[model samples]
Target: MITNDAMTVQDQRTSKIILAIAAITILLATFAGKMPSGMIGALGIMVITGFILNYIGDRTPIINQFFGGGAIVVIFGSAYLFHSSIFPASAEQNVTTFMKSGGFLAFYVASLVTGSIFGMDTQTLKKAALKYIPVILGSAFFACLFTGLVGMLVSKSFYDSVMLIALPIMGGGMGAGAVPLVEIMSGKTGMNAETLMSQMVPALAIGNAIAIVMAGLLNKLGQVAPNLTGNGQLIRGQKAIEEEDQSTAPLNVTTLGVGALLAVTMYFVGTLLSSVIDMHTYALMILSIALIKVSGIMPTALEQAAHSWYKFVVGNLTPALLVGIGVAYTDLNQILAALSPMYFLLVLITVLGAVFGAGLIGWMMGFYPIEAAITGGLCMANMGGTGDVAVLAASKRMELMPFAQISSRIGGAFMLILATMVVQAIA
Candidate 1:
């Protein structure tokens, strides 16, 4: 009685209905941890929850309009579940364990970082890399100036504002930015590193949350005024190059295997380079891949393979990874506890300053403003890998990851340098 198209629609609806029930069941079930079962069950639950929240976000009024859709929903919804005690402690343990011990987060990042760099054109890579450092400096400078101004107005010292709030937000994520910063400030100001970390960590959490929300708002702005963005493109003059990554490689088993190996090996190479350089492994990996990309030495077939694998991972696993981010990284309670009028104002100002600086400078350099703000700005303001994912997902610009990593790693390094200098000068 029905045509093929109608039958397909019906099938899709049925699938959605089943997924909905499964999602609810995950919420209600008492899951146990036993290696494989624990890993599979937790992953399944997260994926289902993420899809449902994403769907709900797409439907919600202000959330959908201002935040773009499910990325924000998945983030906060996961946090809400944890905060509300709807997500069981055992399930949370299982999920987090898998994310870390089982290395899902690392695995996911390796694939994307490897692919994003290799996929870019050599000329584009060379040009973007050459110009991105100055953009980062401007983003950092404005963030510090604005945050310090707010801090002084709120009865906090200019030194405290620059050291605790502005620097850490621009310092990349928690480990690279705040941890090292704690050590630096401890030596400079005679504050206990742990105590300093406790204060600084909250700023990062709050800043990351604001950055995600702002990313969505920026996307909305891009929609209202198309001139401000290259849609998903970072560079204004460059063609979209490829339309939102349509990987038609058939998910060939051999190709995927090669791609996965390539991803892991690149990560390993980064780790090795870390001993020689003081930067994070991911940052090092980025540098190595970028160098290779711009060198024009990698074979065409390999480049295509990396892009194919990137497409596969991005298409298939992005939703699941978002769910992991909700459970593993997004912590609402920490943010809530850290809020004070002065502290909150300082963090907010820092994020806004980053947005303004990066947007203006990048626009001048022939980069799209929205892309610049999100990558060059919010990427600094947010919590590194997970933050980058959340911001990009919110802005609907996942392809700009190469630039975001540059912001986090190089920008983080720059922050460390700035912190040292500020401490020296102030002391």
Candidate 2:
């Protein structure tokens, strides 16, 4: 009984007992309408569901390889749960409120954006930045081209396909990309925003889902064709950015606090600039951070602290965040209702075009093709911020959050301009 094996088994039993009790207590509180709101109830439900789904996804055969592992599972699974009434309506509402109103998604992205940029190797970053925009443009070009051609054959209207389907899917995400697009298009065409949104929503949702899967596939491709990927590095000659700074002192509470402060401050600054700059806050913040990093204004100590905070957030909160994305943003019904064979084909074509297009141009620009495709193409094609997080997570390249954000914000903005010009010309 006192043997090591016996002791280990006993420990396992005790841990299981405690977990079971906790789970039951949470379930009882949830069913009895006693689940607390804010961080307490919301985080518990999200983290637990995320962990369960993540475990299943990682263990499943085909899903583990090509379907983005836990990221996709948690997302789709939570969406289904949210709709199926398996989870209490109150719990679902709590998660949705927390993700949206609580600004958890923004908080997560802010951490990554600041931390990743600060941790980047300046030389590689500089090189990559110069070439990144071209890759994004390339993706948009091919995505539109491919979607338009396919739309002509199937729907008999090239303009409708390109404008309605291709552009919206690649425009960024809901709030920044599709919603604004509906307004702009509605204003120009004298159409209802609701009508435009109807076409755009399914496109955005389906495109995001496909993009997440494609990210996973690209990750597997990277495994098969090792040369095509930087394993999170954007350029070939540069080593992957080190997650932890070697010269920095070991992490402490003070450093984490500093990182949190800096990240929040950067986001706030971006928001402030957005009021005057006419650009997305994420995009503005990114530009500011890059300028600060390049100018050598931020202290090395502060940079390390920001990076540490990013690592901590990525490591701990990614799963929980994915769950929230599922409950708050993804609409299973919309995805299912729009699952027509031709619609699926068009959406798939758009995503493929983005990936291949971005990958090809990225290679020419001296960036790794897969990394470029994921950040530059898939990120653009996803649901915006949440999409960026999901795409990067599925690709196993959270370190490239800076480039991904750029693709979403700047790339999305470019789509709006393109859409406006195209509408004006063809109208």
Candidate 3:
């Protein structure tokens, strides 16, 4: 029999080879013209291939981490290089446009509706409603106020770029709710939704990357931002743990039925509410689903359903939208030319402003220091998107890792709404 050590070595080598193949395939697919019907197919294959490789690496912990991180770095880096060279002008626009179109809409709606149907209960719903109301409303007020101040200080183009930055940050931070708000303003104002979305996606992607980087930096800085005690820890800490436990629980028919019922109800409610609110129906659907899960009316099966649904929506459905955005890239050079010196300044200001302000607020409120860093990083990510936040978070490490992920997501969502309102006021 093959020695265990030898077998393990072989597995590692195999895993690496597989991942490398996937990486090369993704690169070729991204740049080469003959692979698929359109950009959507190309992106779909790339994302799917990446995820699949990650999934296969799951059994081997070290290999998983190494390959997963490596894949992300390679793919994202190549994408950036590709964007800069081939699609520079319209890269950003392509992302924004994909985000604004029905593709994103479908992705968000599906995720929210399915998530609500199976994931939430009335009690959880009520809590989320209560929690988010103050947070979102406060964020909206502050966002609008800030936008006004910025408007007074900046040019129209500057304001436009700021809004662009805010879109992905909001989406990543707040979830799908922010997308509608971004889409609405883009559509009404004729902001070249496609172009804006394209730009926003890469920006967000870059921002997420930045957020990840910042996590490492914050740990090194040892700024001692804040630390939540038992209560806060209990509230936030239970999430991942609870989710893990939930995953192990068995699925039952009754629970599944109830979850389905609730999901269906929320979908309709979201649709109905969207007509009146001028917000994304997906947002309302998510809200509705949260209510169902929190209420505790459903069986435990609903939890599983919700998880599956979220995976479907976020993982499967959203990628298509991403691809659509990719296809929208017709004039990358124009986008680059549009980037004036002031734009860079604005980017800096926005990044620092959100990071310091939000980080300080989170720290003072007894959040973890890492969470505080994430809060800061989120200001950049939500406006930019996941890529930026990832960059920011990855730059840091240790305690900051959780914070970057959690706080940015929390803040990004809130800010998306706020940013949308800001654009509306300006219009």
Task: Tell me each candidate's TM-score.
Answer: 0.92, 0.94, 0.54
**Model 2 spans with C-alpha error above 4 angstroms:** 1-21, 240-249
Worst lDDT window (10 residues) for model 1?
Answer: 28-37
Candidate 3 has its poorest 10 consecutive residues by lDDT at 396-405
- What number of clashing residue pairs does each candidate have, in the order they appear? 0, 0, 92
TM-score computed on alpha carbons, candidate 2: 0.94
Scored by lDDT, model 3 comes in at: 0.44
Off by over 4 Å in 3: 3-32, 38-40, 43-45, 48-81, 84-128, 136-277, 308-343, 356-427
> lDDT for each of the candidates?
0.84, 0.90, 0.44
Ranking by lDDT: 2, 1, 3
Superior candidate under TM-score, 1 versus 2: 2
lDDT of 1 by residue, 215-298 (tens): 999999999999999887777877555442234434587777788888899989999999998778888999899878777787
Top lDDT prediction, candidate number:
2
Candidate 3 positional error at 6, Å: 4.4
Q: Which sequence of candidate numbers ranks them by TM-score, best first? A: 2, 1, 3
